[model samples]
Target: MRRLAASLATAVLAAVGAVAVVGQPAAAHGAEVFPGSRQYLCWEDAQTATGQLDPANPACADALAESGPNAYYNWFGNLDSNGAGRTEGYIPDGTICSGGDRGPYDFSAFNAPRTDWPTTHLTAGATYEFQHNNWAEHPGRFDVYVTKEGFDPTEPLGWADLELVGSVTDPPDTGGPGGDNYYYWDVTLPADRTGRHVVFTHWVRSDSTENFYSCSDVVFDGGDGEVTGIGDDAGTAEPPAACPDEAPGAPGDVTAHDVRATQAHVMWGVSQSGCVTGYDVLDAATGDVLAATDGSPMVDLTGLDPGSTYEVTVRSRNDHTGAVSDPTAPASFTTTTTTTTADNAAAAGACTATRTGASACS
Candidate 1:
């Protein structure tokens, strides 16, 4: 989970008092992770040791043949730029899984209804932490729906067959944008749901008209998020557990700067409560503490390897209540490397200083 930190800056532009002046066409990426979305898991399955896309699942093969690898490469792009949260009346029934094929890529082939396409297993009425990848984070509301009982999986999905299972607005992300990071929330599955059912999620971005859609094939048959139908991992892949959503987790907007070969500085906003005794800097990937600060907003990280990337999240510790707040959306930094030769250093400095005025650094 190396950091590809494109801050969810647009998501919090209002708070920062900034206006977006984007010139290039903006595209976002993400999809449901748990109860693995069709596109998400297929993308995972297509990955091969030879760096080639070879899908093993029959339905995945059919989808690959129809849409090509482009759709699978951009599995998170099942979105509609002009959707603006309009559903039922706007997106047609058969093509709902593809966001009506209005996305930047052609994902129409994924809309085909199939009983096999890598599915997640769950027990009826069980509470589980649902996850949606935040590959490119955005401010949004999520509407999670599951198919009604007696819903036929062999036929294309329709709006009338779905029932609202849960809804959450702007949930907390496990880390910053990219690399297995996701927006997390607890969802209680309907008890009556059995057999083959599709868990559909509609993401309505509040900042823009862009909306994403995900279709997750699942069966409620007394299992624990174990997935089936994808090579040897058919029933071995277990869904990840959700991060705790505790309050007063040090106000967000955690940032890093002054990165160096072995040192860097990270800072964030203050906590809301007086019970916060200190702060802990945690590795965003494993949620392990790397450093601690004595109630300081900023923490200096040292002993980092040169030219290596690290992602870290911050948390507030309340000694009085014996409570620890949730980690901040991760801040990623890569340490810089230095050369021994004086000539190399001077060349590097000159290349960096006025290189901004020139097109090439060399």
Candidate 2:
């Protein structure tokens, strides 16, 4: 395979660890030839051609030698090479005429009476990908046309024509002109439609010639299904121990601090067993668990009387095992209140009257 070339800036960027590049064209267009031999033959009528062979003609033997079993190419001669002087340089006129060669290549063998046509079975609502494996005759980019079995091959597989799909270039390993290039297209079947579907792929060359081939590897898979949960309810068997656990662990390092407006802030470090499920905030004063969910780290308490103290704590929960972790140490904080001089004097007077034990004038 020829190495695809890259731009200097691209090379420099890759060297600097910025980006990775792939599939660059190594040489200019048409710079390289097909890797192997080009000449091949397909017989029109093997029985008639065989009987017509003249035993006296040595050229006929060479042509016959080149035409192997099933009338495929016996040798890869320089048929398409530009250096070959004959028009359509690769296949020679002498070989074509001497061995009963027709003006165009014969593909009758691809159809029945010669060989069985390839069959493709597709499922409903599934996307199918298709490609061609051989690249000898059809080089350069091409379009694949599909149609119903009863219609002419030239007719397109229109909207009502069952499911006509195109594929990306066949990968080089699969025998595309470019090494192992795969042409692909996504096709989906109607929900209610099922049964046998016939698919055909043909390459339209630069000369507007159509070279047809049949394949059976196109496949279909049903569309996306319902969403699935990932925990105990998910029905899948428990994974190995190495997998993260859902249970919560012991809590630690509880701390409480003051905030404005009779509110206090609570913080704690949650310990996890295997995996941290989530955390919970609790009202320490009433032993009431306030918030319960995963990923919340802090909570605020409000509406308390000024100069009053309050306690807060937090606990963690695990998602996988459905376990709740131990609570963190309790912490406390006091809220502050504002007072004027008049209010202080009134408070002092009330305290003095209460201390004197006098039932003075009401």
Candidate 3:
């Protein structure tokens, strides 16, 4: 599961209101790999030797055009920084696949209604080995859901159309982080399930409020686990040059303010020569991207460890090139051990990470 998020880089945590967010994670994530999710399949469908967007499928081509190639490049990152295991009502109806359209990259275009999405052929009522990628390993639970019988593939998916099938808590994981390695498990498809349907996966991390969602288009048409609609037969030709020169340069004037028990605000100056789609907030100590935000110049980092000091850096992002700038000067802040209205999440009632770590209010 190269589970990258949509282009909505901001890690927004809107409950009944709104909280401004900018930037998101570049790496350190995961997604479904066995029954390939739309992003995964689209990435596979469009992955070129040149790292450019040239999909053979119509749906993948459209998604690449609308959401850009980074949607597939960082493919395993479609996660929300503030999900907290909340589903259905919290994630809305049609946008379930994109984690309510909140995460590091733009995956909203993948929610489009199309049946031609590269599909996996499987037989109904079969016990199959399931695999979820561990591109970035974290302790978590993987919930498996499948669409109900007589499901319509041409319409936007809604929660009502799905039924929880199985779940595994921190299942056995193999392979190293940042590789094809994955968490493996066994899933028995519902015998009643047939025809066109989707296998939805929700990966809820135990250590944080972050959650990764994957939507795999599949059919129980009496076939094995053969995938269709992707063309890599001819293989590598002279690859086209991707849009890398347009990658944004490093940002500067980085600063953090409004520090609190579980939150801090990061701001930076972007004077790059090219497009700067968003910023990635990173743990300066680990170099792992903590969260992603929109194109805004500032972002609020929530869910900090109280009384702990942290140093962070901001890296400018270019979604088109999937390139991130060098780290801006590190900015440091310490979380206040004391609780506050912001930390309490009085109105929003949801929070992301700060190190960024995950914390949620009751």
Residue pairs of candidate 1 with colliding backbone atoms:
none
Error of 2 at 31 (Å): 54
| Predicted candidate 1 versus true structure: per-residue lDDT over 155-195, tens digit per residue | 98999999998999999988755446688888888988889
* Candidate 1 TM-score, C-alpha based: 0.60
TM-score to true structure, per model: 0.60, 0.25, 0.63
Q: Sorted on lDDT, highest at the top, how do the candidates line up?
A: 3, 1, 2
- Residue-level lDDT of model 3, residues 1-362, one tens digit each, is 12222221111111001223211222236788778788877766664433334678888889988886557655776888888999988998889999998885689998887798889888888877788877556777999999999889999899999999999898887754434567888888899987899999999988678899999999999877778887653232444554556777677677876677766766566333555556777888898877665444555666677898988888877777688888887888888889765466422534443332633221
RMSD (Å) per prediction: 18.1, 33.2, 10.2
In model 2, which regions exceed 4 Å deviation? 1-245, 319-321, 338-362
* Greater-lDDT candidate between 2 and 3: 3
Candidate 1 local Cα displacement, residue 160, angstroms: 0.9
TM-score of 3: 0.63
Span of ten consecutive residues with least summed lDDT in model 1:
16-25
Worst 10-residue lDDT window for candidate 2 reads 23-32
As for TM-score, the candidate ahead, 1 or 2, is: 1
